[model samples]
Target: MTRCDVDSVVQLQISVSAKRLLRRADGPLRLKQIQEMVIAKLGRAVDHQQLLDVLQTSAKNGVPRFFVDGDMVGLTQRQRPGPRGCKAAGESCPLQPESFEAVATQAQMAQISKATKKLLCSLGGCMPLDDIQDALRVNGWDWKHEQVLHALQKSAKNGVPRYVLDGDMVRLAEGPSCCRRAQKHAATELAAFLQETEFSSCPWNSALSLSSFRGHGEFLQHVVQDERHSDGRPRFEVRKLHGADWIFATESAKLRQQVFEAIQALDAEVQGRPKKLLDESEDMAEISRLGKLMQDWVSGASWLTCLNHTTLVDEVPGIMTRVHLFDGDGIEVRLHMFMDPTETYIHNHRSNFFSYCLSGRYWHKIWGVPDGEAGLDGGHYFVVNRAKDPSFEHPVGKPGHLSVIAAHTHQERGSYYIKAVTPHTVQPQMDGNVATPVLTIYIKDKAPGPDTLVRVANKQELASLQQQQREQQTQDCRLEGRHRLERLRAMHDLTVLTSHSALRKKPRAGVPCKPSRSSPDIAG
Candidate 1:
């Protein structure tokens, strides 16, 4: 047979499920390695397309279609030879390569540039724009000034990870006097200026010395060691003795960041410790970006798209994760998973749910129209969601009441579910020895009043079942408490006697066992 172009059939590992088939081939072959697998199954000179053609065919017929899919290929009982014959057959197999498992190819997994890649798991709202820029520089990466500004703009809380000294490295300060001379000279000159001129004209009546300076506030205090006037006369530069100036700055929410720092400091004080900073090594910009995305996901509202049906309670039997609750109070998305979805009912719009299985090993099913279930028209469904024919505003299922359903349908498990727009009822179950799905009634805008009003003909049996549950619980608690008390007594008895044995046994050291002189005497 003529082979297809070599470029079209890339040399890739066969799918994991396909490799087992190659192993059972009657001819000797290296089935593990891709290159060796093809050569071992066919002659070394066999064209690559020819090998792929066989693989493709097997892939199609594999009962469990692509391992990810539910359809999988299973060898029939007839396909399996006797144990003795199989071992003998293995000796004559052409499979040789051991590393034949298929995986996502490099081309498929190739990542885009770092610039385009979205970051994950980051703190929102940290630091002023300028500080974030410095942090990136420390890591030897240059960030555009505008990009950093944009990051700072997005966060509601602009806070960055604190920088701490490394445990392995010694942290010696830029050691005193780096800018102390500047501070000292500035104070001296200011004092002279005050004496020569009016103290009111001076910014301060009292001068601040280098000794008065603190970190950050002091570090940026003196940018220039010495500043000169136009006449070349040495003019003392009075540093602010505080962090950078924020007056009239263009950094968005600069003041907010400062307030946040103040709050953090106060919190640290209440905790009876200084705030500790971790590695100053984080991309504040990317952290800010992810923070924004998370914020948007939370803050933005979701518009519900209505799918077909009202009062359709579908349950997949046996799936413990069947009770999948989809809840959104317009802020949080809550999904409660159970073995069966039908075991749930909407009581007061309790929750909505939908899901589908991608793998069949865990069998599931959903009972619904199933091709020909007649619709209960004018049933309970919102007019907003399904607008095509618009469901009536009245709630379905006997008009604000509970319903029982037993679902037994479909061959493979059901997953891949979606419930949107309005809250709906769902439960899940697995295949084999199918379990029933229970649904609690949903009473919107009303407190749960009571259970279904239907009276059971066998009241005694119902009471007995309830009594059995309560008894079992009480018995378990009593047994646990009894065992606990036994352990406590055993542990305390030995220690107590040992600690006070002399007190209990001691009566009188020199006196007889008879009465004492001051006490009543006993006659013989």
Candidate 2:
């Protein structure tokens, strides 16, 4: 089925589930209870967050007729069905709400309870009794300390998703699983081992030599076990980022080594044959070959998971995917994926890198301060020393062979080299629901300058850009254009006021931004 069709079905099922759960209830139920009931009745896996999103949407649309309270949900007056909607006098009604005891017998419910316990344990082994009571107390269980403790103890004894600690401190008597101790040991050892031996590369950099680490076997075993017994939720930080086994270290290194060699060979040929002025087509053809090579290298490798810390710089969009394909002694390969309507703030990198667009097209721009001095003052971009007046700086050479325009085309599925000091930004070509994926191979220089790259656009410029986007969106807005326009105006006024306050605090002198010690890095 289509995604929309599936979503519609899920929405209807959720609504039906809510109605059945509240059919005979006299008051509100905790969201947790509602979630448990919904899952039990549907006999399918569903995310609690997903349920919340759908419920919120339903409320906005005036369906399901439920409202949310603090961790609780209640049926609206119109939604509380009468007893006539329940099953016939003797037979049990599937639509009628069941006590937690009735649902607890199910294997799925037991597993969920165990997961909850594990999550609580991860936060801290010990929690207040009140919080534990809320978790263990299912429907029909009186909110008594003794009853909650008894229920948890019974479950723990069954060895079905058992908990080691189930008392006033809401502790885990047992770990998440039988080998949880080993898993924790491996995870800890690997994290420490990585810090010592691995380079501080972003997720978009290559995976360091995991096999070379002392406890490689232990780490691999832990990951394998974690993956095998995973219950959807993450138990540790690494799992939350890339799960347990997104990529095999040995295989990734081997493939990356091959790609690096090929790139080296290409560079040698280009350098040796400089007399044979290469056309744009020839350069692009070479890039296409490299792209094919990368595809072959990643034929069996898993590179879809997020690989790096995304917050490389502030004010960058959080929707992009930066995956490191290969990191070698003097080079690194990365895959960058940008979602629709992306307009990244202007910034520069600290290291030299060559990028090849693997898919889609984008508009790129790069601006550099003349004489390496520039700053913002009174809502305008200026290039000058702190002692002089501000003026605009002209663009230096760009990566691609293109004339000056509003934005350069970071396209052609071909490679182009960008210098370490060059400042640049990219945005979706049409600025709508499109994705741009690029592959970049960074060449680390032995003596690159201190890389202190910072955002060049002042608050005023950013605000104006945002306002333009809002205005463009409003032009196409059908049902909500009026409301959006009002919001846009309010936002613009606020921005203006904020900018004025900021201007008052600005130093009226030299460049708005001063170059600091450059480090080896890239822009967000």
Candidate 3:
């Protein structure tokens, strides 16, 4: 044979040996390792440069079968004929059999490009090329790694490239920082609108229009669409109302509707009489019914959504999260989550309300003074006029004592009704262990009023209140609207998990396995 024939034979032998070695290996093999193994398998001396040249030539050809990444090498993953003798099986098969040897069509390239961009976005806009290939395979894309790369290259040829390949890492050419910033800005704008409107749904022209969103309408819509596709509950939803688009806070809207229906049913049963007039037995039965309603709502996935959209989340650091669910006419509903065993200062409410415990335990104390007495014997009185003073500065009063008129250990599913101007305080129960989180629902008989009174027993107690206020202000500054919503969702998820696990334990006969409640007179 001539010298050219001998060279051809050596190249074929080296290619087959390399392929065999790679196919047998568990993962990508180093170039040096491939050469050594191939030579060992051949049982003869072989030139390293010749092997490299053969591998490189094969990879550069139109029907490339090998992938060379720096010093590492591997067999390229190609789509094999399915069991049904087609590239895609079942209903996904094309009308005609597709040839594996043919180049990817324009439509195929476009689909690959779109999927690649989505994968990059989900991966924070950068990923190793191998990882991208593996992810594409996992997602059921039949395209080979070479096909994906070619499609990306073709898509970038005419304009600013959307993606860049550096060494083995594939990244978005423009990076993801700008996109994330725009998304956060859009979320902030929407959150601000919802907060300003008191979580009420608004027309598209009012909040989502280009003019209203300052020319970011398209981008905002994209952000909202992406959020909807995510695993977490979406922040805003667009609904058609009277043939026009309206923006609704997703969780708040659903919760408000549920509460409205519940209240309507209750009103029908009361027959125009004040709800407070229900005798003890009737009131207890109503409370139980409402408790069941709450239990059903909280047990579902929508409760997580409610926690996600709550505007008053994390209002008090380490103490409470008060979510305002609904406020209409003379009735308001609020959900409170208490994390610590701290007791609220003795205080009075400006409206009658019912408290239903959703989980955990607390000590409910009612205080009162004799009809002819000026004040309690050992209490420092402070009139809290939040209407006139947003700072919650307390007006001083003479020190006095207060008698504990009624005290009860409020357990899970327990409920209580307190009349307007009734003095009360709630201290979470601590039975020689860490404090359990307490969740409560409050239904008020009137619109929230600004005037209430708090009585502290000593200077230490007063100082603690001042410290709590300072901490709350600091926390409020640090937590943005989007972050607050995320934090609240996480907290709610953890609480639900713990509560569910506790409920799974063996139950005692004749005792209910329901959750706990919150402060009777606490303002939303």
Q: Please write out the lDDT profile of model 3 over residues 1-524, one tens digit for every residue.
A: 01122377778888888877876773568888988887898887776556656775564346555655545676654333588555663323322212223446899888887887777665345667777778888999887665676576556645876666555566667645555754666666666665455334677666645322444355556656665424367777787889998776665435545655786565444444554233334455666677666655564444544443434444555557766666555456677777678877678877767787777778888886545564444545454544454344564655455557678877667788777678788888886788766777777766344367766555666667766666565343334567766655554454455457666874798876543433244222
Point to the candidate with the largest lDDT. 3
- How high is the CA lDDT of each candidate model? 0.28, 0.45, 0.62
The better candidate by TM-score, 2 or 3, is 3
lDDT of 1 by residue, 1-524 (tens): 23244433332333332455533643223323444555655444444444443333333343422111011122121133346344553333211222212322333222211211111101111123344455555756465443332232222213521121121111112223423454445444543443343211223213322223212232223422344444443333332425532111111122223323433432243234232211112222222232222222211111001111121222222222211112222111111223333333222222222221211222222222222323344222111212221222222232121122222221111222222222223344445566432111110111122322211113343354335434443121211244433322332232233224424756687853321111111221
lDDT of 1 at 522: 22
* Model 3 ranges off by over 4 Å: 1-260, 267-283, 305-319, 370-400, 431-433, 447-450, 458-483, 494-524
lDDT of 3 at 207: 65
The true-versus-predicted C-alpha distance at residue 136 of model 2, in Å, is 70
Q: In candidate 3, where is summed lDDT lowest over 10 consecutive residues?
A: 91-100
lDDT of model 2 at residue 89? Answer: 50
How much is 86 displaced in model 2, in angstroms? 92
lDDT of 1: 0.28
Best by TM-score: 3
lDDT tens digits by residue: candidate 2, 1-524 = 01122377888798778767766565667778888888899898766666765554464344335544335565543432247454445433332342222223445445544544654544334455566556555533334443343345446455553543321244455555534554554445444443333221123122224422232333344453463313343322223235433322222334445566776655555445534222343454555566545544433222212222231211113334444444444344455545545566555565655566544456666655443232222233422121121121221222222112233566533456556666667676663454543333233322344353433344455355445545443121221335433332332232334335545767668856221111222222
The deviation in Å at residue 85 for candidate 1 is: 80
Structural similarity to truth (TM-score) of each candidate: 0.16, 0.29, 0.42
